[model samples]
Target: MKIAAEDVTPVAFTVILFLAWEGACRLFHIDAFILPAPSAVFAAAAHYWWPLLKNSFVTLWTTVVGFILAVVFGITLGLVVGWSRAIYRGLYPVMIGFNSIPKVAVVPILIMWFGIGEIPAILTAFLISFFPIVVNVATGLATTEPELEDVLRALGASKLDIMRKVGIPRTAPYLFGALKVAITLAFVGAVVSETIGANAGVGHLMVQAGSNFQMPLVFAGLLALAVEGILMYALFALLERRMAGWAFRASMSAAG
Candidate 1:
């Protein structure tokens, strides 16, 4: 099989960026404590592979669990809100107000309730990620065409029938797009809560390394997080392509 230039571009760019970083570090005689070079970060990762692997897994687990919860709850609520104009109008303001508060501030309250553990991290991840999913799904469904609805009514389609046949299919692209964004936010939420309260996770490991002036390990932890986030985003992107590729094709055809 032949590899496409599109597939190679990001890898090439990343390599160039890292090479530049390594060169700059050597040229400037930069202190390792300030900004560890790529080599130093790699060395730290190799030296403490077990801790990095363990903490990375812990963070991934919490993030995935939280994201699952968000998907279930978010979809359910989005459908409810999208079902009616009154419900959508009544709820949008409250949801906006809630989402507006910084998630970090809510972490303390979660810790107080859950007592500084994985629960707080999980809840924080759930809280941070669900809003976009809800908003996107609701918007998709609520924006369904009135002309189509009238046609469906003329054809003797019930409200539920129209929703099942049209609303959800149309909403799939929006929901999947939301999923990609939500997963990243979930990771952020998990790591933030871990940094503040949890006993284990990449965030906690980074904090410990920073305290001991282990800048290389701190950067390695960051790298682990980036790898995880990228993998998850890619997974959702793949799933979106598989599940809603028709939508993309339709839109492209329309544009053309």
Candidate 2:
């Protein structure tokens, strides 16, 4: 099959970015400790491949597990909240207040409770990601047209039936959108907790590298996190296109 120009753009853009970065580092005679060139970063990644691989896996595992929990709980709670405007409004402030507390503060509490293991990282990821999913799903359902509901009601559809048949389906685009955002946040959450307390994970690796003055390795750890985040986001984006392609079609039709 032939490759699309669209598919090539991102790769080209990334290459250009890396080249610019490398050129700037050379032009400025930047110290590796201050900012490693992409070449040095790649060398570190290659040299510490095994450690990077193991730590990256640990981070991925915790992040994915926490993200899964967020998806299940968030979807259920979002559905319940969106079922009625009263509950949505009532719970909105509570959720906002909870989400407002920086995850960094909560990490220490989690470390105390979970004792510096993967559990804290997992929970931290869950806590960080949960709100966006809930808000987006709830918004998707709550924004359902009142006229549409009235017509369905007049046709003898029960509220539950209407929600099951229409509301949930319509919420797909929003849920998928939230999934993309939440997954990235979940990674950030995992890395943050790992940096604070965990024995394993890219965050911990970076911390070690920084203390040892291995700036290239530290940058390599960051590169690993960026790569993982991009992959997860792309997965959700693909799922969105596959599952909610109709939403796009509808929007385009309206626009035209």
Candidate 3:
């Protein structure tokens, strides 16, 4: 198979970025404690591969668990809220207020209730990631074209039938879009909770490395997190395209 420019561009840019960063550090004689070169980071990763792998797995599982819970709960709540204008209006403010609060603030409370473990990380991820999903699904349902609903009703369709045939289908693109956003947020939430207090995880490893002034190790932890986040986001993006290809094509065509 031939390589496409779109695929090559990101790889080329990433290489350029790392090369520039490494050159700048060498030229400026930057202290390793303040900012380790990419080479040092990779060396740390190689030396501590086992620990990094174990911690990365812990973080990945916790993030996936939390994200799955968010998807189920968010979709259910969004549907309920979007079923009626009154419910949507009443719940919107409460949701907004809750989402506005920094999730980092809630990490301590979760840790207190769940103790220092994966449970806290999971809950923190769920809390931080569900908002966008809820909003997108609700908006998609609420904005269903009235004319379409009228035609369905005129054909003797019940409210449930209209919802089943129209509202749910319309919400697919929105839900998928939200999934891409939520996955990233879930990673943030999980890592934040782990950093606050955890026995194992990339976040915990980073904290230990930082305490020991192992800047390269800390950067390796960050690199692991970045790689995981990018992979997860890409997975969801691919799913979105596969499942909602028509919606995506329409969007692209419109933009063009």
Q: Which pairs clash in the backbone of model 2?
A: none
| Error of model 1, residue 153, in angstroms | 0.8
After superposition on all CA atoms, what RMSD does each candidate show versus the true structure?
A: 1.1, 1.1, 1.6
lDDT of 1 by residue, 1-256 (tens): 9999999999999999999999999999999999999999999999999999999999999999999999999999999999989999999999999999999999999999989778999999999999999999999998899999999999999989989999989999999999999999999999999999889999999999999999999999999999999999999999999999998898778663
- For each candidate in turn, the TM-score is 0.98, 0.98, 0.97
TM-score of 2: 0.98
Q: Can you give the lDDT of residue 193 in candidate 2?
A: 98
User: 2 or 3: which has the higher lDDT?
Assistant: 2
Off by over 4 Å in 2: 254-256
The positional error of residue 180 in candidate 3, measured at the CA in angstroms, is: 0.3
